[model samples]
Target chain A: MDYLTIIQILDSSLRLATPLLLTCLAGLFSERAGVVDIGLEGKLLAAAFLSGAAAAVTGSIWIGLLAGVAGSLAFSMLHGLASITFKGDQLISGVALNFLAAGLTVVIGQSWFQLGGRTPSLSGDGRFEAWNLPFADAMSKIPVIGPAYDELISGHTTLTYLALLAVPLSWWVLYRSRFGLRLRAVGENPSAVDTAGISVVKLRYAALVIAGVLCGLAGTYLASLAAGFVKDMSAGRGYIALAALIFAKWRPWYALWATLLFGLLEAIGNRYQSIALGDFVIPVQFMQALPYILTVIILAGFVGKAIPPRASGQSYVKER
Target chain B: MNKMPKWADAVLIPLISILLAFFFSGLVIWAIGKDPVVAIKTMVQGAFGSTSGISYTLYYATNFIFTGLAVAVAYHARLFNIGGEGQAMLGGLGVTLVCLAVPWPHWTLALPAAMIGGALFGAAWAFIPAWLQAKRGSHIVITTIMFNYIGAALLGYLLTKVLKVPGSMLTESARFPEGAHLPNFSEILAPFGINFSPNAPANMAFFVALLCTFLFWILIWKTRLGYEIRAYGQSETAAKYAGINPSRIVIIAMLISGGLAGLMAINNVMGEAERLIDNAVEGAGFIGIAVALMGRNHPIGILLAALLFGFLYQGGAELSFWESIPRELVVVIQALVIMFTGALDNMVRMPLEKLFVALGKNKKKEA
Candidate 1:
């Protein structure tokens, strides 16, 4: 409850929220374009592995980011090929990508690193170093704002700031741009967009490609956090992002708040694995389960309904 | 009116898909600087070369059969119940509770009681999601998947806090009583004068899985409930027009699905591990999705698909043990199978359809 403790918790929350924020935006891009991407988890995992491996091999953080994003892009294209071009079941395609990523990452990692499905730990330039604001030290001596700025706002990996910046950027692009208008139209009514000669397929694929890049950043952030890649490092964060997306009701601005809330919950769970509540001890497992349980409750109509795009999960057939 | 025969749809498509998956998997192995042929041969030999391997293969197959049927039953009602992993975890807890509540004199006496406990617990877990979907318009896919994570955390707590053996560091319950252990394949085959590996975990639960498959076939194809489920799956509006209540079918189908998923605990807990432990369900719940798809959501097809996955799993273990190929390759292979059989079916079917149409046109010209 103290000021410093609160700042410390906020710091952890910000770190945890970064991955979720990037991924939620990723899901936002795909879902808004009429694609249900359950494979967000797969893309994140693939990117994490690729990023870690590339950084380890090349000893350059920038190369790692490039390789990671490229890997995610390849998978995204595969998803597009299956769901868009083949007119296959979108859900099935997403699920398959998840499986493929889970398997391929470990297989390649073991072969390359020989460390039981984990990448070599990165150091120095191989990982993103924290950025210190120019006036952080000087400002820390001033007053409450100074201390708060230094403690809570100044130090984060470069990707964290990028993830935060992405929210308003996403909102601007989604609401204020012509391409965004076309993208939203394709999701809601592909036929109408088709009639307008806007090329629904191209718009949707473009959305997925953007999603791939964001997922790439999310994966890279995860790798940068630990400075290495472990097996299944994405864990269930991708699913958590999907839940966050639903919690946000598919809006870009709301995604930031939702992911932060989820991240805060996780931070508290990590800080207090066991807590004394009056005479009873609260288990951390309950805290860990809270986000999922809340999602179920929200979806059950305790809160307002979260409606997806009408054209989602459907293979748009032009002639029919 | 039709160029392609129904039999081709049933058999040839899956056959070609599996072939294509293997072909691609071979290329992957080749890319990794390994011999695909030797790798595959090793997998085959490992899965079936000995009585022990066969027992293990059949044992893994039993788990897949239960979970596969769980998915298939729900699929028939147009529900994608991805919570089988969670349900099976809860089922393990239920089985543990039943086994520990009182010491039973024999496996036969404990089996039915444990099955009932597991089924009810799993059904109860699924009821909320089904209700939400049926009455509140919650998407089943999202809720069920969310439930899997919740179920995992819940099970983790239960095993660590309530079920752990006293003074033990591991997060697992104490071993079941002697009489609670199911008879293994060796014991079962002894009366027939056949030799089998006593060490293998294959047990009476395999028969239970087979019975469930038979029951699933009857429920889906032979019974009125089955007709309602299929009708509902095909066209919800049409089913409603025909007087089948959508909500009722949804709840009933989910209940059956949860029950089938729960039964998987019998194979893993009482039959193999003989102790309730964390992660006992492993990834079998997700694998059930692939099995259901490859099986075409049919009982016979489920049996075949389950066996195929069982082969891959056992073979993959062998491959990792003998060759440098990683065990994760098994998952890659499974994913490929799912992709081809489920998502990319049109890739194979479109060409086959064109060929059949051409042949039919030639026949018409001759006539």
Candidate 2:
């Protein structure tokens, strides 16, 4: 309610929103290339577990990040092989990958750590520490603006800044680049792209790889948040990211705002058990369910029409 | 004309897929420095070694049968009803309300009433998603996924605030009346001189699951509605030309699917726990997808597949208890089965087709 309270909420919202932003952008790349990626959740979980394990074992956050990306990349490639190369059902592939990650992480984690499917608690360089921005201390001494800047803008991990940076970078890559045009074209009409001599398969694989990298960052950031890995740690955030993607209508800049809104909802839910408005009280469960309900409404076109790529969720078969 | 035999398509492909899944699961066990053979032996002994083990396996299978049939029914209409989890949760709520509302003198009367309540709630939960997909061009998959989360939240809130037993800290409903308790396997078999585990949760719901599977077969193969559903699934445009209503088929198929998913609550919630608890469905709804995939959306196949999963679950519990090999090994195997059978089918099918074609040529030469 107060300025400091508002700033504190915003601070937590940024931390929560970073993973969603990264994963949403990851999904954007995959879906924009005519590949439906419901496996985004699996990739996030896989990355989170592997990154946490790597960080704990090697005592290097960089290695953990790399391992996380590699884990996500493995799943992305598996998805590409099944849905694109084998021409199997994309949704089934995604669902299977999710189960695989959910099972494999705990199995491997338990076998290695013997801590009931959890990595050791990370400390020191194994974890990502918040970076205080330049002049943050001096800025805190000033009035309301200074405290707000220090609290809201500074004191986030490096990954948070990168996630913020990724929004513009994604917008540039998707809107301004030559590859972006081709990617959009492929998603809309892959046959036309094929006719134009661009290999649909190659473009899709490339898109999946990019998605894997972004998902890797998201997963590593998640591990950093917890300071270690826990079973089922992603905890449906990947799916929430998917909803955010739909809420944003698959646009990059819009994705940032959508994820931030979702993050704010989550922050509010964490901060309050219920919100009371005069005689009326809203339940926390309602807050938890709000994003999913909004997505359904958006999908049903009750709020705004969300039209996906024309060729999305379909495999491209070249005409003889 | 260049196709494998009907028997191969129905049986052999799935068989090979299961083998591949087991092979990979064994590899994972080995990678973790455990003996896969011993693990398998332990699982087999644990799931079927004693009457208790068998009962547990059957109990788990009963849940899977309901969910598997749910998925299979929707698949026939080409509507992937992934909202089974949410539907099942809602179904539990229905069962709870029905059992608690009337202190029934006998379960014989209570069972049918609970079934209706569960089916109605589950169908109601699924109706919005189905309607959206049928009328608004929304993707059922995404909408259903959203509904799962919403259902969980709704159930969590209800259990914590409205349904909780007064003065109890547990987030669960009060126990059902004694008369409403479905007879367990031990009680059911005692009159026939068959000794069964009294402690096992396997109950009359297993028989209900079998009955549903039979009904599912009749609905899919013997009825006009089933024919329409299959027709719609194969080609909606063609079915439309043939005067079948696509929207009607989608809605009906989803309703039946949701209803079947909801019926699973009778097994776990009413039969076993006798109370509605958080996470009563416990991933059985998702398991239904894997079961339907392996079974090729057929009733008999679903039964067999559900039993296999039931065995894996019971066995996995045993493995964890004995060898410290976390129970998640079963989940890993389930993932592999789903992957090889559903997503990576062509990886097995293409090679098999080539093999069959070559064998056909060899037969011609021999002739």
Candidate 3:
């Protein structure tokens, strides 16, 4: 409505989009390497719980981050072992991993904390505090650009900035790097990559590791958002990230915009119970459902053809 | 070409898988400093020791049977229908509307009408995803996942805005009419001199689930449509060459799957709660995936798997009540079962194949 209100919404949008961006890039790497990872949600949840617990117990955010990443890495490796090494159905493996994360987090959390599957709330260094960019105060005097820069671009957790940075980094790693070309090749046709002497299994494992690290960061950021871990804290954010990945058509730069859009929708939903246009009123639930609905429509090829990698979801088998 | 005998494939694999799952679950409990043996004993006693426990287990199994059959049917056509949660929720809405539209003279007439309504709504929820997958080259898995979220949102809006009982803070519809009540297990068994727990929610829907299981077997094995579905699942190209329409098979299989998922509402919503509430399906839809996986997508196998899960659920509840072990322990067990049975089948199968091959060689030497 007003300028300040709009600024506030945009600020929160960036904050909400941080986890999505990180997780989306994570999915991008895994999917681009011919490994379908529906386990991203599980990874996020595990990371969130472990990070929160570590932060609470150790009183160190860095240790929490490490623990979170380790948790996600374990899941990613499990997924790789099942879908890559065992050549099992990738989707089923992901589904199992999700359930495993969902169950294990609460079970372990309840045992350790005895707070009904919640980590103790963190304060001070136990959480990631927002960092204001240099000259934020001075820039506020510049009117439109100042407030916009200060509010929209500046003053977010270090993870938020890293998430934004990852967009370019992912693009470079996916398109400009030598490994990127080979990784893309593996996803499109693993046989060709194999013929070229690149081990498809190794490349996929590497991609999953990268995905695991990114998911770790995302999960830690989520714990930081709540200042602790709650039961099922990831709360479908992983699925939303996957939806954003599909919406972006697996491109890194497009991923930023897609996640931002979804994030904006979420911010708006949180801010308003409903939007009224004259006599017509839109319920908040519609806003909550819009991202998924749009993804379904995009997937149905109404918006554009979102063709996935050919070898995606298929386990590669070497010919004897 | 078969590495193992038919009996082993049908029974041995699942038996071993379940054992592995329970073993791992025990390890988790031990890690948490709890006695896994005591937990298991408690679960067994709680789920089956009393008439109430058995009834509750049966009640939960009723929901699982419907959803498990839903997943199994779709699996036959190679369509993974993960939107069972949404479909079941919508099915509850359908049951609610049917039951509330008029005071039924009797549940005998109401049951069939509610079944139709539930199936229709559930099928309708699944139709778009099925059509997209069939015609537009969209991935059914992603689309179905999206539909689950959408279905939840739709149900939430309907409950808060339209279905909530007036003057009540709870986001649930008014209770169904007296005649719409389905007879519980106690009432159903009373005439036969069988004493059951009157407080248990287990109802005639359990019988309906059993009937559906029988019907599912007939549909999958005895019908031309089932043959076509299996053919399509095995190889779409070969099925096309054999003059079977892939799109038709996909649509029909998904419809059947969605309909079965919807039928779960009859157990949880109509039979148990007698009111439509938010999250009525709970996680049964997702559990259906695990059930179908453990069952190997067979109707009889699904029935057994559903019963196992029902026991776990009832037992988990008892564990939480008695030992405070947390009910999510059951979910952890379920995850392990799914992982070992579905995702890591080769891990078990390879060793068994080797054992069987070695045994066959020994037999040849003896001969």
Candidate 3 chain A: 10-residue stretch with minimal lDDT: A149-158
RMSD, every candidate, angstroms: 1.0, 0.9, 0.8
DockQ score for model 1? 0.85
Chain A TM-score for candidate 3 is 0.99
Off by over 4 Å in 1: B1-3
Which lDDT value does model 3 have at B261?
A: 94
Q: Model 1: per-residue lDDT, tens digit, B1-367?
A: 7769998899999999989988988988887788999998999999999989999999999999999999999999989888998888888888889988888899999999999988887887788899999999899988999999999999999889998988999999999999898999999999999999999989999999999999999999999999999999999999999999999999999999998888899899889999998899989989999999999999999999999999999999999999978989989998998899988988889999999999988999999
How far does residue A13 in candidate 3 sit from its true spot (Å)? 0.6
- Per-prediction TM-score, please? 0.99, 0.99, 0.99
Question: Comparing 1 and 2 by lDDT, which wins?
Answer: 2
- TM-score result, candidate 2: 0.99
> Of the candidates shown, which would achieve the greatest lDDT relative to the real structure?
2
- lDDT per residue for candidate 3 within A207-294, as digits (tens), equals 9999999999999999988999999889899999999999999999999999999999999999999999899999999999999999
Off by over 4 Å in 2: B365-367
RMSD of candidate 3 to true structure, Å: 0.8
- DockQ per candidate: 0.85, 0.89, 0.89
